[model samples]
Target chain A: MNVVDARQAVTRAHREEWARVVAALTRRFGDLDIAEEAAAEAFATAVERWPDDGVPPNPGAWLTTTASRRAIDRIRRENRRDDKQREAQLCYDSPPEPLGAIDDERLRLIFTCCHPALAMPTRVALTLRMVGGLTVAEIARAFLVQETAMGQRITRAKAKIKAARIPYRVPSAADLPGRVSGVLAVLFLVFNEGYLTTGPDTDPVRQDLTAEAIRLTRLVRDLLPGDGEVAGLLALMLLTEARRAARVSAGGELVTLAEQDRGAWDAALIAEGHRLVRERLAAGTAPGRYQILAAINAVHTCVRDVRDTDWSQVVALYDQLVRLDPSPVVALNRAIAVAELDGPEVALAAVDRLEPDLAGYRAYHATRADLLRRLGRSQESRAAYDSAIVLAGNTAETAYLTRRRDQLG
Target chain B: MQYLISVIHDDSTLATPDEMAAIDVFNDRLQAAGHWVFAGGLAGPDSATVIDNRGAEPLFTDGPFLESKEHLIGFWIIEAPDLDVALTLAAEGSKHCNRKVEVRPFR
Candidate 1:
């Protein structure tokens, strides 16, 4: 193989087999540091040797074997000879199962990474690194965190998992339903980080985090196909992703729903999103927060014109969502729809009540600013816009708010 | 693997009769399941003393090492294969004792 082709194959193999190699190593060696380092070394070796030797027929198995050797070598070099023989016996594990077994291994790695014992951010960082096969630098860049600090967080998390003996197994049946939501939460956070990435210097939209989140969520969905929330999450991501093209203007400012060009939205993603939403609707099961939210997005995407949108259906979905999650954020979103249906005066009352809870939330301020502007209270609206612009983290959102505030003149 | 499930409380209130009954049942279940290793409640932190001996002259303190509103009132060291089992047991223990619990792995 040519050098460039060999390098591309190595990259593809790293993406495909990193998690499997790491998961299998972790199960055998029972050490995150050892498993992660060994997998990385194996990939590095592939880069060095694949150009001359050609790619292996079964890259996953090849990577796993190389990684196991690296791990065992490290064990011997570290003078842990007492564990060497015993660990070698573990290396002679049952023959690798088909795809189903690989899925289970990935599931275990994911559940372990998303364990509730670890803090939320720790779970996100670890999941990205271990399960998503992302580098520490890449993850840190996505979240706008210092690489050193993010590295330490992942290090401490791995140590805790090892010391605490966080098992490399999925939650039991009873725990699965509740715990899957936690896993979904981490994935959703990754998706949102990509969707409306923060900071001035960073890209307003981080396709990497969003794409990774969708990829990982799809993996979870496949692993737990019967999960409604998982389906709902996937649907929600697809619907949101469908609008990605039109969400930002040519100037890189966020285009509100009312202003985005309908022509720009991806038809295929919208169709897929609509199908998932419809499947859940036909299932006759009571919807969860994500399902209801996806339904709401489906409503928004189903329409070709902003003026043709069904305000009542959107508001109804938000009402259903409020029952599931009575957070101020949901209430604030509901109020936005309320503005369209019940007019700004009524929506303003609801938005104002959420102020105590969402005082610092940029969207809350932006919503309030829009409602006040509709009521012809330009001065109050301008002030609300100011608060929103200041609090806005995403460059696109900030620019959008700035343009809106200027337009109040 | 073993987890130290520390029972935490904000007040000096001892377990009520009902709570003690529940704890007994929970402890019995843990024993039956082979998850029970050791479990006990402690007196108030006022009964504890702290001694620092790292210095040349050992210093003695009359109270707990750190005085805080919430303190460890009891604990259970339960043996389990992994954290999931340990966490579920800790949750049950917390419910039985009617107090918050924290789990930490022993090195």
Candidate 2:
């Protein structure tokens, strides 16, 4: 194969097999750091050699075998005293299961990474590195931490896992229900990191991270098909991602949701997401936070245009969301929806009530500014816009707030 | 895996009679479930002694392992398939003992 095609093949394999390869090595060597390093090295070798030698038929298996061999060598060299024990451990490993059967290795890796004993940030970082197939640099950039710090954090987390003897297995069925939230929270954070771009010039969409989160969520959904919340989370992501393209304009400026070109949204994604939400709702299980959010987005996508949207239904979903989530951000969103259903005065009152809770949140000020401007309180609107501009991290958001403040003049 | 469940209690207080009865029932449950290995209550920290042998000769001292108002008044060593099982048992142990329990798996 040509170099271009070879590179694309390698990238695809990397996305599909990184977790599997690393997991295999981890199971064999019983060391996460070594497992990750060996898997990465195999991938690097593939990038260099695949152009000359054609891509293997079973790339995942090839990577896993190569990584396992490297791990065996490393273990032998590092612990000569325990060589016999290591060898005995490898000798009894179960043969690879058929390709069609469920691969529990990736699930085990996810559970181990998101173990509650580890700190929340450490869980997110470790999950991104191992399960998401993201480089330390990519993860560091995503989280806005120094590369070395992120690297150290990952190293420390791995050491903690080994030191604390966190088992490399999926939780038992009884424990599974409680642990799902932690895993879902990490996946959502990864998606949000991709969805919420920090700078104007950076690509509005980090498709790799978003796609990775979706893929992982799909795996989780398959593992827990009976779970309505898992389906709801996948639907929520798809629906939010469907509007990603429309969230920006031709010149890299922020497009308010009310003014976004709905036609630009992905129709296929909307359809799939709407279907999932309906199926989950029809399950008639008690709705979760994600299901509630997905139902809200489903309402937004159902209408032909923003003005035709059902504001009361949107407000009602937000109300449900606030009861379940009860966070300042949800309150801010509910107030914005209230503006469309009720009047600016009522929305303004709602926004003011959240000031104590959402004092540092940029969206709170931005939403208040919009409500104030609608109420003909130009001076207060300008002041609110100034706070939003100061708090805004992205150039596009700051520019949008500046323009709104200027318009109030 | 073997796990150590340490029941932490203030030295100023002792277990009530009802708590002692609950703990007896809990211990029997652990024994019946095949999770009990060994367990014991410790003397107060003030009556403890420590010995250090890293030096050229042994050094004897009259204090607990570490100085603190709350100390491990009792502990249980239980075998379990995994941390979840150990934690569950530890929760019941704490409820019976009427004190906070700290659980750590043996490395």
- Most DockQ-accurate candidate: 1
TM-score quality measure for candidate 1: 0.94
Candidate RMSDs in order: 2.9, 3.9
**Candidate 1 residue lDDT tens string, A1-409:** 8999999999898777788899899888878888999999999999999999999999899999999999989888775656765564355333333334335788989989999999999999999999899999999888888999999999999989877878777776667778899999999999999999888789999999989999999988888888899999999999999899999999988999899999999999999999989999999999998999999999999989999999999999998998889999999999999999999999999999987899999899999999898899999999999999888499999988999899996
- Candidate 2's displacement at residue A14, Å, is 1.0
Model 1 residue A13 distance off true place after TM-score fit, in angstroms: 1.9
Highest TM-score against the true fold, candidate: 1
Candidate 2: tens digits of C-alpha lDDT, residues A1-409:
7999889989999988898888878877677998998998899888998899989999998888878777767777866878775665445443333333335788879988999888888999999899878999998887778999999999999986765567777776667778888899999988876777665456655777788789889888877788888898999999999998998677766788889999999999999999999898788888989999999999999987888999999998998888889888888899889999998899999899998888898899989999999989999999999888887466666767787898886
What proportion of true contacts does candidate 2 retain? Answer: 0.33
Cα displacement (Å) at residue A244, model 2: 1.6
- Candidate 1, residues B20-91, lDDT tens digits: the string is 999999999999999999999999999998999999998988989888999999999999877877888888
How big is the positional error of residue A169 in model 2, measured in Å on the Cα after superposition? 2.8
